[model samples]
Target: MDPTEVNVPDVKDMNIDNITQNTILINSQCESERVKYLFERLVTHLHDFARETRLSTQEWKAALDFLVTVGQISSDDRHEFILLSDILGLSLLVDAIDHPKPPSSTEGSVLGPFHSHKAEVVPSGSDISSDPKGRPCLVLCTIKDPSGAPIEGVKIDIWETDSSGHYDVQYAEHDRPDGRCVMTSDEEGRFWFNAIVPVSYPIPHDGPVGKLLKLLKRHPWRPAHMHFMFEKEGWDHLITALYIHPDPYLTSDAVFGVKDSLIESLGSVSAEQAKAYGVREGTALISRDFVLVSDDETQRLRDSNALAAMADLFPGKKIKLLDHLPVPDLD
Candidate 1:
C-alpha cells in the first residue's frame, strides 16, 4: 500500500473538538473490520472519559508512566499486565463474555498469573507436594458431561498455595515444582489426589496494580481455592477453581473469580476413610463433580440469542480457549 494513496484527514490545527474525529478517521484505514471497529470504539470511549473527567495533561502523563512501569516489571514467569486486568475485573468479565455455559456446567474463573508449564504428571492418589506443609487433604473429583455420563481421559492440571499462602513459584529461589501436578481421569471419570488445604492468600501486591488497589482502598486477598484446568478432545476446555466454603474472602475475592456453584465444603475424614483414600489420618476431604460442555454445544450457546446479544461484536470469530499445556510424562 502506497503511503500517498492512503486516505486520511489533514491533521493541521487540531483541537479537542475535532481530535477524536480525526483519530478515528485515520484509524478507519485498518484492513481488518474487527480491529477497526474495536479501536474506533476504544478511541471514542477514551476521549469521552478524558473530556468528561476534564483530565489534565499531567494526569495523562502519569497514567502512561504507570503503564510503562507495569511493562518494565513483567517477565516470562510474572505477568504484571494480567495482574492489572485481574485487579480491575476485566479478566473475569472477558471470560464470562467468551465462555457462556449451561446452568449445569461448571463456571469458569480467572486463571491467575501463576500457572506454570513445568508441572509434572503424577498418578492418581499420589501426593502433589513432596513434603506436607499444611492440613492434609484428599481431593476426589469426577469429570462428566452435561448429561451425567462419565468422560474419561480428561487431562487435569491442578495447583494451589501452601498453608502460608504462597505458591512454589513465589519463592525467590524457586527451582522445583511443589503444590502442583497434572493427571488424567480414570475409566470412571474419577481422579483423586493428596494435597494441602489451600489457604486464603494475597495476590502479588508489590507492583503497580497493587498501588492502584491501594488507591481504590481495596484489599488484595483471594479466597482459599484450588486451580484446575481440564482439557479433552471434542470438549470445550475449562479453566476453573474450587473455592473453599466458609472462607472469609469468598464474597470479596480480589479477582472476582468466585461463583456460588464452585464452592465446596471441606469435610473431616476419619482414619478409615483417609486410609481408604490413601492419605494419612486427620486429612480432610473435598469431593466435586465437574460437568463439561462439548465444543459443539458451547458454540451453539455462543450463537444463541442470550449470549450473542452480549458478545456479538466479533461475529463468526469464536473465542479460542487458552492453549493446553504440554502433557508431561507420567511418573
Candidate 2:
C-alpha cells in the first residue's frame, strides 16, 4: 500500500474519540512514502499506547523531561540515548530486523557505542593488550566464504575491555594501549592477535538509564565478549561478537545481544600448546572462522552498509525500493 497515495487520512475534524486519525494526518506531511508509512505506523502505536495506559499530561511531561536529561548528558565519549536503547534491547531488535543473514553467513550483533574511527592498526600477531591486568589470551580468527574459500585482504577491526572490564576510552589519557587494535586477514584469511581475556562488566551507569534500571530492579551487566567488525568490497560489513561461552551473563545479557551460533569455546593453553601459539602457559585461546555470503546475493546488503557507513548522508537519500519490503507480520 502506498501510504502517500491520494487516500491520506485527514484529522482536522478529529475529536478525542478519533485521535488515531491525527496520526494519518501527520503522515500526510512526509514527502517520502516509506517515511510516511513509518511515521503513520509509529504514531498509530504511540497513540494506542497512550490510550491503553490512559497516560496523563503530567506523566507525558515527566517523560519528556527525562529524555531531555538523557540528551544533555550525551557527548562524543558517551551516548546516553544509545545506552538507554541498549538497556531496553531495542538496539538488538533493530539490528536483527535490518540485517538478517543466512545460517552459513556470520550473524550480526550489537555494534555497541564503543566503535571509534581512531582504532590503532597493528601488524599481524602483535599484542594489542598493553599489560597483564588479566590473564593472557591469544585470539586467532579466519575469514572465509560460505564454501570455505579464504578471503584475503579483509580488514578486521577489533576491541575489547581488559580483564578489569575497562575500555581504553574510560581512562583520563585519550591514547591508552589496552585491549584493542585493528588487523587484516593475510593470504590464508587468518588474522591473529594477543590480548587479555575480558570479564563481564556493567554498562555505564551514572545516567538516566541507570535510574530506569533502578526503577525496574534490573542488573546492568553484559557477557564477556570481544567485538569484531569484518569489512570488504562485495561483502556485507559484518558486525558481530565472539562471545566467550560459560560467561555467567551469557543467558542474561543486559542488552539481549547474544546469538546461539555466536557462542564459541575458549580454553586455557598449557606450556606445550602455548609454545606453538607463541605464548607462555596459562594463556586462553580462541579459534573461530566467519563465513560470508557470495557477492551476487549481497546487492541489497551492500547498499544498506554504504548508507550506514556514510551515516545516511548521501544526497537526496530516499528509501530505496529494496527497503520498502513489507513489514514482517509477526502475528
What are the TM-scores, per candidate, against the unseen true structure?
A: 0.89, 0.83
Q: 273-293 in candidate 1: lDDT tens per residue? A: 766886667668888999999
Tens digits of per-residue lDDT, candidate 2, 97-135, equal: 566576779888898877766688888889887765677
lDDT of each: 0.86, 0.79
- Using lDDT as the measure, the top candidate is 1
User: By TM-score, who's the top model here?
Assistant: 1
TM-score of 2: 0.83
**Residue pairs with clashing backbones, model 2:** none
Candidate 2 runs further than 4 Å off: 1-14, 270-277, 295-331
Query: What is the number of backbone collisions in each predicted candidate, taken in the order shown?
Result: 0, 0
Q: lDDT value for candidate 1? A: 0.86
Model 1, 104: alpha-carbon shift in Å? 1.2
